[model samples]
Target: MGSSVDAVVAPRGVVDLRGEAGAEFVAAYPADAVVVVSGLPGAGKSTLLRRWSGAARVRTVDPRTVHEACEAVMPAALPYAVYRPWARLEHFRLLRSSVRRGGPLLVHDCGSRAWMRRWLAREAARRGRELHLVLLDVGAATALDGQRARGRHAKARVFARHRRGLERLLAAFTRHVRSGGPLPTPEASSVLLLDAVSRSRARSVEFGAENATR
Candidate 1:
């Protein structure tokens, strides 16, 4: 059985990825904890997690490739995006099962809304696994800048929708944090809110540390 937790009351403000956000995030973590990075679509969540835990130690719950491979098996009525969260469900189940059988420290790269985070915490608690959340805070301009800087895709094609999506993501993040629940640690000694644009070395150290832990 799982335990229910009370909601969190957060301070209000424009929490840009400046110095303050990093301090706030780090203060919420405990020592020797596996960090879960949360942020907007283009908010560098994956980059931060990879840098903090090293790509090798970072186990993602993203089954997008798998879903794509077995696309024919999926319902034709549902779109590709609709299958995203469903695929994540499989990955989460896989992670839970693997941990039971003694697997590596997996860092999930998905949109963990506050409610979802609470659910995950409950599940982890039931299985005696620790959970930590690291929220990536970036401004609209910063997100737009990051999108414009991307070379992997045609930015011109999705820039408009991407920005709108980011806006919704940020609002969701705010709600999640405000309605926060208990963490594995009472309070974290070190929490990293990385500015993906600058400070690559520090980010690499965070990743190195996580990989070393695993």
Candidate 2:
């Protein structure tokens, strides 16, 4: 009976060994690493990752999918909205195994609050992996201009979401820079901040500049 138990548990021990030594063994198994790209709408997060494709980029449609999933589970508007944030948490967990294996960045396009970004940083630190942020510091005026120039299909639900999201991004930016937090810097890892106003015709002209290098 003791021999049988040992045989049954030996495989689990090997699995634990693989999991604990993930940093080294990840190379053999091909794990996925996600680099969250966040900014206000028209900040070019999508364009950046799309232009420079190497690893697999996974997307999280928290705003839309999470809402739908919530309705399915709860069948009430209040609970759906209230528990939406928790539902999005699943994305982080899904990336854990992939992160250990280390593959392509899971590009997160949604505009997350600054505090949320800090939380994500903590998660990255605990996992022994690096967290990089690409902050496209386009001013509100510029963002508004970009939005106005957008095609009919590109218009989002309302101006409120952008306004609120912008406020959050700016506040987060201030906290990120001055708070002495783990926010990525050029020397630490890589935090690239591009000024959109410095370039014109942002869609093709200015955006093209970065693409040219790629």
After superposing candidate 1 on the true structure, give the runs of residues whose Cα lies further than 4 Å from its correct spot.
Answer: 1-17, 20-32, 55-58, 63-86, 98-106, 109-112, 151-201, 205-214
Alpha-carbon runs more than 4 Å astray in model 2:
1-34, 54-87, 95-98, 109-112, 145-188, 197-214
Residue 16 Cα positional deviation in candidate 1, in Å, after optimal superposition? 11
Best-fitting candidate, scored by lDDT: 1
Give the distance in Å from residue 26's predicted Cα in candidate 1 to where it truly belongs.
12
Q: Candidate 2, residues 1-214: lDDT per residue as tens digits?
A: 1221112110100111211111110111112223555556655555554533422233332333444655677755465447756766755555454455543444454444555656555555666655554455566566666556663223455445655775665464466655645433321233434455312112211111111111
- CA shift of 78, model 2, Å: 12
Model 1 earns a TM-score of 0.52
* Structural RMSD, model 1: 10.5
* Global fold similarity of model 2 (TM-score): 0.46
For each candidate, the alpha-carbon lDDT, in order, equals 0.45, 0.42
- Quick one: how many clashes does candidate 2 have? 7
